[model samples]
Target: MTRDKILVVGANGELGQALLRELGTEKAIAATRTANTPHVGFDHVRIGSDGNLPVATLKRCAAVINAAGSVAGDDQTLRSANIHLPRVIALAAKNAGVPRLIQVSSFSILGAAEYIDRTTKERPINAYGRSKAAAERLLLESSSDELSVECVRLPFLFSATKPGLLAPLLSLTTRLRYLPTVAGNPVRRSMVVYADAAKQLVAAAQSGLSGISFVADPRPFDYALLATILAEEADINIRILQVPRPIAASIDHLLPALGRRLLRSSLLDPCANRVGDEPLGLEEELRKLVRSTYGS
Candidate 1:
């Protein structure tokens, strides 16, 4: 019997590579912009950053997982990758009769939508968030019941492979004039270990789960609490200041351009903060992140 063919766009990406490992030993095509080391169950294809994917090969695949994304530039490369690439994939999948397509999106889009003006609303205040939001919208608009198109809006992701949210925050702690104060807001957010997110993603693909789903930390906490935990692991003490929402919002506007410089590619671009509205086990995941980053 022929095994199902899974194609992973951006297969060389941090998340894509991890997801490839999780899928393990499947008949899959891993697409990247440059040559990469081959994995056991997959064949590597060097694709252009532009949407010049192998259409014929794509058609034969059973599912397509798009992890390709970008942020930065007067180029608006994000529009092509985040918006056009997915649309092309969807259309190709439809023609090829592929059953499902999973697009990875950012939680920031959800956060910034209500707060920012419409002109830049869809376009993230930060470059990265704009890319992700555009990609998510493209996926949603292109999908229908006939094809199983699902968007996985991920929050802050953590893993040993790279220093994530905690890294910069920990760095910030060192420079603080004083320990920041904890805020009382029960803001919802979700995060997942890269390995865990990969496992769930591959499993969901194989299981053929439909509709939109979010994989996040089962719990969420405010920044102050997060800093405290990091400080504990790092063997330092810290405090937090609770900036009121009005002040926070004002800052978000005043520093619109500051986002690209500070955030780069993170979900924490305060302008595009998409804290989860649903329950997510963020604390437990943070513990894992701390262990991985600081060592158990």
Candidate 2:
């Protein structure tokens, strides 16, 4: 094993795989509790639990990239994976004297946890978001002074493997052709391609930056605008169904519990919606997603 080892947690995941791809040919370890299939050159190690992460895994690692997240796992499982895992990883890294840690966190951490009622605040309406938010806090409050941790709060991540924000919404609209545009559901929003998000993460890891970075498309894109693009580019035709704002939020609140999870993620998910208003740009890099996904 090379002295400069990078351990990528959740290497089997879409973003994790992308991050490994970005690392390309570097001496790295890919870990997952799930069975690992072929993924580039790295060997897969099964960590059934966060506490089960092998010490030898950390012994030779120079940096640990935590791309681990649980979307549908049990509440305890999700909490263990998201919150407990990061803390354990940080502690391990600190003990091993690793220099940097790159944690992939969710954009939802910035939600109105303080302002909105806990019941209504969109901190994380689903198991996935809650896990990520808790994990983000763990990473933030990590006790490892030796670990230079970089937490990236990411918006919707797009890739061929997993549907991005636009693709899922577009998929839902494909059959219906029309979607209700509610007052609160901001049509324009910011998102990032999985590849690009991975690239930025790798870059940040290489740069040795120790802080939080908000990663997303540098432009405001609305669902209406996105729907139009998909219809034109992907050749899916749909109508815009305008629903009331309160109804949309209400629907967002009840859908998961009722098992009627939105076919397309809620545009009203508090964190995802606020990204549109942040200071971002229409960089040349972002236009590539349009071409790649929608075609020229």
Candidate 3:
């Protein structure tokens, strides 16, 4: 029996590679820009310079994963990958009778609302987020019965392959036995590891789940617990020193910028509907991430 074919755009990218691993070659066809991409021998769909994808092949796809995007680039590059490409894919998918189109987005689109929900309007702080917000709007507008377009607005996604914010901090684990964090850090934000995000995206494709969806652990995330996990995974002392406010302030500059940013209060409301699930909780995901990155 023939299995469902999922077309993964940006097949050479971090998330695209993750999705390829999740779906495997038998089920997924990687969409690359040129035949000369790193993926030399795989089922390929070469998107054109004009943002035109071959609609004929798209007709056979059960789902199209619009994973092509740029996290950092010039304005034209961001618009091309994050906005125009998605619009082009959406129109083509609509015409090709594709059942689902899963577009990758970012939580940055909403900026730092004290608590973000579906009702929250996008107020991106950076060019990347702005591009994503625009892309999401275009995709959602293109959604219809024939083509269900759902943009997975990812938060702090990490993995061994793409360590993201975790790389520098995790490296510090080797130098410092215990990380000194602000005591009673209560900030909770959406987060997902790369593998899980890929799995969740595949599920969304199969289920034809549509609309804008924020992603990550739906439960309360504890910074102290996360610090411990990072320490252990990095093969350092698994002690998280929760320094008091007065003490923390004396050396708060020691904290990495990303670390300070994370400790700040910004959470997605628990009631807000999101896509990815963290059945094993955020701690386990962190464990998986560090282990993968360190090859431990």
Candidate 4:
């Protein structure tokens, strides 16, 4: 029997590239805005011009995976990339007779929820979160017998190739002998290794499960533990100074921008802390990332 063709949108991104690596080049069709050169070790099609998706290409795939997102765009750009793009893909996939649509969504949509699961309601607090929530809504509402949609909500993802949030944290911790943090250093948050997340994404695409599912590391860690682990691995000594949360909250209240940033930080206010069955170990995954990136 012949294998079904899978289309991956935003095939040039970190998650997209990871998915391609997991799924292999033979079974996947890479779609991006520009097909000028090879992408993720595969030839790709320029699926969109400006802001519109290529309906013709979408109609030909057996399944579609949307890994595209806008992390730091203005209101209009955010809406277009996060909301409009996914909406278009869902409609085109439905029209094209595509059976499965896997949307790589974010944990930001859940905001500061302590324990996030499929049943947890979305309470987006920022523009990016709102846009992602809106996109997820559109895709879930658009699901049908012909087109099954699944949204995989992911936490902070890290890899050697893409350090992501870890890079900054590592830099800050390594440079300072003493790091000051809010009182919530023990607040654990969900995280996943990029390679592990890719496996889950591929499983979701092939499993034919519908609705929302969260993929995360088996264990959650707080800022203090994270700093200690990094310091020990890097062979450095650092002290963590915990300030009062009330003082930090007061400062945040005085400065709106800082308040927003603080609210978004997983260390200060975690969104997800639940674990799944046979999940990856947090320390093991962190060690892999550190070894790959820093060779320690």
Among the numbered candidates, top lDDT falls to 3
Instruction: For candidate 4, list the clashing residue pairs, or say none.
Output: none
Tell me the spans in candidate 1 whose CA falls farther than 4 Å from its real position. 1-3, 38-41, 48-50, 113-131, 144-146, 177-189, 207-211, 221-228, 242-296
Per-candidate Cα lDDT values, in order, are 0.62, 0.64, 0.75, 0.73
Over 1-296, each residue of candidate 4 has an lDDT whose tens digit, in order, gives: 23276788888788888778877877777888875523545646776655445666566567888988888879999999999989888887787778899999888898866566556778987899999999988899998899999988888887655767667666776777555567754446667877788778888888778988777876664566666776767766777767688877776679855543333344312232223456575667676666665677
lDDT of 3: 0.75
User: Residue 204 deviation, candidate 4, in Å?
Assistant: 0.7
The segments of candidate 3 whose C-alpha lies over 4 angstroms from its true place after superposition are: 1-3, 36-41, 173-183, 218-222, 230-235, 238-262, 273-285, 288-296
* Candidate 2 residue spans exceeding 4 A from truth: 1-3, 34-37, 48-52, 111-122, 143-145, 164-168, 183-186, 234-296
Location of the lowest summed lDDT over 10 successive residues in candidate 1: 259-268
lDDT (Cα, 0-100) at 108 in candidate 4? 89
Positional deviation of residue 147's Cα in model 2 after best superposition, in angstroms: 0.9
RMSD of each: 5.7, 5.7, 3.7, 3.6
Candidate 3 clashing pairs? none
